[model samples]
Target chain A: MTPELPTPRVTVDADVLERNLQAMATRAAARGLALRPHAKTHKCLEIARRQVELGAAGLTVATIGEAEVFAGGGLDDLFLAYPIWPSPQRAARLRALAGRVALRVGVDSVASAEALGRAVPGLEVLVEVDSGHHRSGVQPRSAGEVAVAADRAGLRVRGVFTFPGHAYGPGRQRPAATEEAAALTEAADAVTAAGLDAGVRSGGSTPTATFTGVAAAPGAQGAPTSPGTPTSPGALTEMRPGVYVFGDAQQLELGTCDWTEVALTVASTVVSRSGPKVILDAGSKVLGADHQSWTTGFGRLLDHPDARITALSEHHATVLFPDGAPVPSLGEVLRVVPNHVCATVNLADELLVLSEGTQVDRWPVAARGANT
Target chain B: MTPELPTPRVTVDADVLERNLQAMATRAAARGLALRPHAKTHKCLEIARRQVELGAAGLTVATIGEAEVFAGGGLDDLFLAYPIWPSPQRAARLRALAGRVALRVGVDSVASAEALGRAVPGLEVLVEVDSGHHRSGVQPRSAGEVAVAADRAGLRVRGVFTFPGHAYGPGRQRPAATEEAAALTEAADAVTAAGLDAGVRSGGSTPTATFTGVAAAPGAQGAPTSPGTPTSPGALTEMRPGVYVFGDAQQLELGTCDWTEVALTVASTVVSRSGPKVILDAGSKVLGADHQSWTTGFGRLLDHPDARITALSEHHATVLFPDGAPVPSLGEVLRVVPNHVCATVNLADELLVLSEGTQVDRWPVAARGANT
Candidate 1:
């Protein structure tokens, strides 16, 4: 007799994903802004296509590898949304990709702009503005200098973009979004001051998307506006929000989305039961060890929300149930929502897509282990 | 002209790996224990073959996917060290695998033991004992009941095995090893009491391998015993230590190995730089976000040991260096040792083998993303 495959593999809720896409689309439409969500979160062509079909004008990617995966899969409009210093090898890939799609690469330094312009000949570039995430991008005031360098190198200057990543901590979303809008507006103005069109003034994280100006005023006369509200309608023309497609623990903590919107989960089986603890087959390798200090545990148990996965090894996740909840028995299956869905998806080859608890399709996480 | 593929994707220092392997082999040999090091850490057939040539009697695997890869590579003696509850699909695979090699499977419950016996007739089974890791494994006292079930179901009973996983964290190596011995001894006694010859009493983690009975007291003596000492002589017939083959950040933190012994490092390029911060191309996706609260950062930078990687996203690791350190320029490559090597390796498809700073071969991490 043969044994069945062990459970607790990565799964995507198609219905939930559709709902997230529709919600983002509705929000973008109300603001009269173009939605070009970042694909770095899902890295799946299918999801990218879904976003596009649901009113996303294009897709934002973080690497050439990701751009290639999406481009090969028929995504024609893409933005490599990082201030990437393209070496010759990467530049050539970028050049080829530019010819095949409406590719917009990011630049933060004069040398990078010049190098990309020389390598690609007719590449479109975006000046990356630092919207307080402080990881990358130039200061909002420096956007003009970078844009002028791109213009001198004969590259097409599009607009400016910033990631309000600082908005993702425990209770920093609201203020971070406001800061993000101000920074993006200043950066866009800098681009225009440099005699550039600044066609796309884009900036928004999942945590800040709701605050992107459109959500500032409710439809009814006395109704309260949603939390994140961008200052003005024309402040930014585009929004790039990833992670909304596959909500995880971080989104839950940041209040970016509610539990009903979380589309991705790891289906694991209870394999061992010790005193006050039940171990699942899904461990750090499967669920990923991305516990933020404030996160309740390694991950949250979907079947029993009160249970906390206290420990994780290579192939085992030990869940500790609260006093009142019943412990899961051996062979019982449970879904685990990871602290970070992006990292978890990167750790698997494929995901089982489910709709209404039935297996729908198996979509390959195209760029699953493409670390380099 | 076609550009060359990127160099230094994953650099493995052969000298360091060999040194670590030799040290563990020497320590295990002086104690009279057979080294059957776990291959789940590296998942490379080259490393597995090297361990066998270095006197490793057999190999330990965590999943059937891993076992299949090694078995296909001609590794004849193998042990699926995980307490897998044999489902029909797995049982068939196990039975087919057993026909090709000396296969031993692990079980922690009478139901699973009986299932394994019925599914794969004539298979050898080891009762898994919980040795304080509290993740998986049955109680040491329950070994007899499980063994009896295996016997009644016509399966051959091997001794017992336990993983002192608690030894992985900081400052717990020694105590965890002691508990491992105690648990294994108790399980072994239970097996004998159940009318089974518990032939192999295995225990030892990479961190606690030195503290096992075999390597314990004899080190202080000037005259070393010929092969095995009276107190430590094959106290446990076999030893299974995985990460010893590729020392990582966890090894350094646990004091099981030194930084100089770290063989594996993710080589990434600097992609973004800001005031007092630099972002590497590899982030949690490549280096893994497996840092415990005690861990300093997402990973440690090899070039600048004092630099701390303060934050990480999917594709970017933000490192902060003190005022006086030499800052890396954009496109300059750097090596990072992940806090948890196992999770990092599982995120890549292949390992770029390097010897003396020169590229040698690229070996596939065959079971790289085999989360299920």
Candidate 2:
């Protein structure tokens, strides 16, 4: 009895969401790791407040705008986990944000560290290291130099962090988790040798979060080279997994979460049907256009496992059903899990809350377009 | 100067935008086609008003929410150019919208046509016929049956439309345009034979818009068959091009537009610089992640043409410059054109207006995230 809401609407099941939040929080606590869940995935203040109530250390945001939103919602501990080159305008906003919360930012280069230090002096900073994902981060060996630069620029070097993004690839989750741990450990050591308090070595992505710090977990093949000595300042100290809160088609395909664990889904209607293709109203605008090369399709139908969304237009999803599988009739509502939950959530202004198959509340995606 | 705003800001060059609007309007006027520009690209009320002022016949939208926004913003006519499956909730909204605006919707099936007729009897409906892109719509020969169903269900069959989406492929613009004309003509003939008023044979996409209705124009390679006899109900009477307002990397690479024609770009700041990779703050979040396999990369830099965005995270665009190309320093602002303009504009809250290289105003994307 999924509520008959508008098509292409995002719906979050409250019952499953509580489980997801508690499960991740419990997992991180058992490993003695700080749970600073990435709020960029679910920009809802309700979700952030719940995460905090579940014992999360803080929240990790991708932009100063997001940090401001969450900080204004009364979250005290906020971290901007991006190599921010704050202009005077963003610097002023960051200064305002820092005044109300325990704000921390990421620094990957000396120039950015200096600019940030000049913008907001005495801000806590984390040296971003490349954990085999060479997008935007310094090498683990060069962390000491960047930390030294931040220290000289009047910023406190807290520790280091790396995103194990490569874990999303096939069969690379454990190896990426191991590389992330090793990179964070090396970077933390570098910062410590530079006479800075490198107490936080953070690393995690949804694919590798389950085995990030705890080597011998409940269902792990092997450990990631013994994730640093426990309790050491250089150990894996924090996890910032974003997509775990709302398991998506990617996480399900990667075996990170089962179908039962998904909390958020797009409710769409079968708008048109051809020979073997069923078009859903939910397309890239609602389900997101994140079709990973390794993924099976654009997304998956939660109830109809055999249905695959083969292509997407602005507002049309071309779903292909297997030979004898039943394709939904026109106007029939169906549940579709997005390929990437974060991209999907960012597309909608609000998410419909559901509990026990009944409509409950509506949570506004307050930071839906907080891109600046 | 580009305003000292935050990184990853979307900017609309007002001068270039006006030129683009006029260029398309003029082209349509010369071709005798109704210039119903697709408003989904910009979603700004100011741009829509300017388009109306430039003699546009009306606006085309992808969703009811978008139609509602434009209609509320003083647009009197709109067409939802998709096979929409309106449930009761959406039917109510559409009913309300049609009460004020000259609203029309697309229908490819008798079921949807009858449903729309029941929801709003006497409403004008367009039979969507497949030209070449088989994502949605019915075969051209089958348009009459759906039109007949709408006629019997208390709805007016106003015309037929086909989206020449295959024109986006490498050298298929002319072929797709030909296919669109031939298909629309056949569908309109079918509807006319069924005693229906098939006056509007609409078709166009950005890549194929210029060659859609006109036989020979400024840059015509050749003519696509002899278009239906002028003044006939089966003639191509309208063009619906969305991306012309904001020329993107896709349009530039397709040769539909030059770099100077680009009106919108993401103003990003260089946050980190690796050996050959320069990371900008504009990522998939700001610049929508619509990377077609045929495209060169995720996006392109407007000023530094040699630099290609190799990869993108949520908040980092990994740009690679060829050897001998001068890379911008950290904190240096640069303009990166998105691959798809429609998706890019949907991601931002407001567009920074620039006229003659100076800041003007901020236009909110009135229909952004209006995914109902």
* Candidate with maximal lDDT: 2
Q: Candidate 2, residues A263-369: lDDT per residue as tens digits? A: 99998889999877888888787777887889998999999988888888788888998998777899888899999999888888899998987889999998887
Residue A8 CA error for candidate 1 (Å)? 3.2
For each candidate, what TM-score against the reference? 0.92, 0.95
> DockQ of all candidates, in order?
0.56, 0.73
Q: What is the lDDT of residue B277 in candidate 2?
A: 80
Q: What is the lDDT of candidate 2?
A: 0.86
Off by over 4 Å in 1: A1-5, A214-230, B1-4, B214-234
How many clashes does each candidate structure show, in the order listed?
16, 0
On the 0 to 100 scale, the lDDT of residue A328 in model 2 is 81
lDDT for residue A372 in candidate 1, whole number 0-100: 49
Which 10 consecutive residues of model 1 chain A have the lowest summed lDDT? A213-222
